[model samples]
Target: MATKEEDVKLLGFWASPFSRRVEIALKFKGVSYEYLEQDIFNKSALLLELNPVFKMVPVLVHKGKILAESLLILEYIDQTWKNNPILPQDPYEKAMARLWAKFVDEQVGPVCFKSVVKADKGIDVAIEEAQELITFLEKELSGKDFFGGKTIGFLDMVAGSMIPFCVARAWEGMGIDMIPEEKFPELNRWIKNLNDIEIVRECIPQREKQIEHMMKVAERIKLA
Candidate 1:
């Protein structure tokens, strides 16, 4: 029983990368919306009603219509709004962006979550997985500012959503400093460019907060 509003509404978890992806798209498009933060541990009835399948956050409610899955919601926003296009107009480029978005969405978050939470065998696996994910990004973005070249597009947002996760885990938890300024120069430049953007900075969840949660989650995983 929600009131009718002629605007977008986002039901999401603050620290979730999936939620961040949708938030980034909304910011880029300048689509003003109400943001409802949901606790993953104790989901609200509203969230459950909006997205019953996964029972997850990042459910985009537009004019009473609900959209689940971050990637699909982004595409829906781009298509519906028809301004500040996230994907390239060219078919081939758009297809490539979609592929990378799918690739990163499928792999990055789960692996990083495992690294943050499970300190046992999962940690070792997550490290290797993280390296593999980073290597893919390094090669894909060899000499470009973003995956879309000079602009943060769909693929950029898709991959960039995970930046806070990797940065926090490496610098805070592991103290590994994996994404050094020299090692992944392109990545470093890209991250700086994204960080400098006002909308991106404002919408993105803080790295320190994510790190703190990661520590708590890790301990819980160990005890469990």
Candidate 2:
């Protein structure tokens, strides 16, 4: 539980879309937090202590309590603030939201990253899997401004962070077109709309920097 005296702090890496998810949630909820940029390659002592098990970025420290994982942190933010609700009120809708969020994070996101970074070896298979995942999501998003219908919700936040910030950048860096505008018009529009939001505008990484970082990762994968 967060308190008035104890400050909210985020430990994150700039290049990680996972970290951006937490940032977007905090901003959308109108929560003021101290952002601590972590060097993921050489992690800081704070990050190490807070998330000793995973040793990863996107860790949230509130009132001296540590919360790891972006999704969990997002839910916590929504629960604590009670403003700009991210999750739906209904039980079933909330469950569905969680389902899609997990799918994007666990399945779609990994496949897209594999497609780009391992392009030389497994681009075809990875791209096919990614396309299938995107197609399913496109169908789910049909006739809606967002996955949550009217406004950006939990699923929107997760998908928005992964698609535009991570997958799109990976494809761009690899010189491939995964989500062609003509083929996936809805997804494209969703990306545009989500990014246009003020909180997202403040949190999303620069295109050039994302591409550069992804390209470097691709090169490393090739060498490995």
Candidate 3:
């Protein structure tokens, strides 16, 4: 296990899935650090100092060196600790794991954005694409407790962040529960299983908070 290092810090926002991804990676790897919550809507001096270009949260500061981007931060955390390896050792498996991560990164943002807009045509298209993504996950998750098999891996961390937020937000807005008890039993089981894990349970933000955040965002979009 990697011992806690001095000056290890996370610049993140509570509601950001990007930030949660890195936070979950740190918890999973048993790394200890300080967390500074940033408001992306109101960019902080610290956030600007860390990531001037993107001006985003989730800047990982370690021993004075700064890293941005959640996936890259996750990789850095995995490599730095040398314990609780999230990616598999085998080259092929590792490749597969990365593929899933990339797929989620490219797809989930647009899907969630459209879902929140509550537009009939846009939401219909978004729902169709979202269903395809879920179907793909269902196939990937077939006969496996996790994408990394018995253990929660890199892909698991990314997926975990989104599903909980999606479940919380969608239920409130659309009244369409994505992770229904009937459909997606395997994925539902995985979500519940993850909820039971100590690290996952601890890192997960409250559902009420997420719902509130989503409501605010939706309201803002309505006015603008």
For every model shown, what is its TM-score relative to the native structure? 0.87, 0.93, 0.91
Candidate 2: C-alpha lDDT: 0.85
- Residues 87-169, candidate 1, lDDT per residue (tens digit)? 89999999988887777766665655555456456655656656677777778898888888878889888888766554445
Evaluated against the true structure, the overall lDDT of model 3 is: 0.78
Please write out the lDDT profile of model 3 over residues 1-224, one tens digit for every residue: 64565768999888887888788888888888899988789899889988998899789999889999988898888889888799899999988888888877777655555554655566567566566667677778889988888989899988777765643364455565655657677887788778888887777777777877777777676576
TM-score order, best first, reads 2, 3, 1
Q: In angstroms, what RMSD does candidate 3 have relative to the true structure?
A: 2.0
lDDT of 1: 0.77
Q: Using TM-score as the measure, which candidate wins?
A: 2
Candidate 1 Cα outliers beyond 4 Å, as residue runs: 1-6, 112-129, 165-171, 221-224
Instruction: Please tell me which predicted candidate would have the highest lDDT against the true structure.
Output: 2
| Candidate achieving higher lDDT, 1 or 2 | 2
> How far in Å is the alpha carbon of 20 misplaced in model 1?
1.4
